[model samples]
Target: MNLNELRDRAYKTACDHGFHDEELSNEHCLCLVISELMEAVEADRKGRFAKVPVDKKDTIFDERTFHYQNKYFAENFEAYIKDCVEDELADAAIRLLDLCGLRKIDIEDFTEEMLYGAEESCNDETFTESVYAISTIPIRYEYEYDYPLGGQLNSMLLAIFGLAKHLDIDLIWHINQKMRYNDLRENKHGKKY
Candidate 1:
């Protein structure tokens, strides 16, 4: 569905769940939409969310240098990428909502539908059609293409931010920070693809 349709459904669903009429109104729906956009954002405060790591080399510790001797060194790069995405991207959505005045209760009630839809669609087939899923794109270009799976997290983020405004919170500052974080390095100049 297009963004507008998803938005309408989310708002309607929130209203049905007993939020105040004005609370789940168009403005609030927009915040929920942002949360839906950033479905990767988890409410967990635990370190379970991806951990950011900085490269540190200590020649004095032979053990540190010994890691490269094993074939598993490449895996660290993968972990680094995952950490960058999980740490910065997901946190941005949550912080934006919080900054915008989205109460924990507000997020709980309004975010279920969006989050559920996103979680359900997290499958190989859906991912194969994603924007970054170029490998799944067929050589033939006759068929039209759309990214139903690529931006669920982004949708969640939008939903929450919109809802925050309804709660009387302004999150322009947080949103800007998120934009900067997301624009970080996407391509490698050397080594692995």
Candidate 2:
């Protein structure tokens, strides 16, 4: 499936998991996405990959659980560490997609623009300009004018895409895996960090 299709699926999955039932504001959604990005950074620093922890039984299944070490290593340690980064990045994209779906944004267009912008940013010598260029996306007030997070969603997506490219990760595949894992969670991955 394409990115847009994935966005729709992620949103639907989140809804099925009760993300929309809680009346979350745009700020809450943005904060959740930011939290996921922070988790990605933490995962990269600590080398914890895969959702299952070494001491699975002891985990509280809350936001703090991402720091736990994984005992279920089926491959090289380096690959596992990379996978942790991939998974966290995927979570970031998934949360952004969920927000786009909730707010009825044209993420396909936004994604296309982001891709072009990213390609352009690749040639630039400075990182700050690239960041500024990617973070700027026009906001529409059609569907939910009162929501503030809608404006920042594109920036989040651009950041995730940039991070994924830097890490040499296939975001779509990781997103699919994360979504599947989310589906099987006890409460739609609600207990997960």
**What tens digits encode model 2's per-residue C-alpha lDDT throughout 1-193?**
3667877998988888777767777667766766666676676667655543434354432223332242322232224433476787787789889888888876545455675565545564343343333333323332435434555575557656765565455666567657766664455455532
Query: What TM-score do all the candidates reach, one by one?
Result: 0.23, 0.63
Error of 1 at 94 (Å): 2.4
* Residue-level lDDT tens digits of model 1 in 42-88: 32223333332222344321335424344443354335423332433
Highest TM-score model number: 2
Error of 1 at 154 (Å): 11
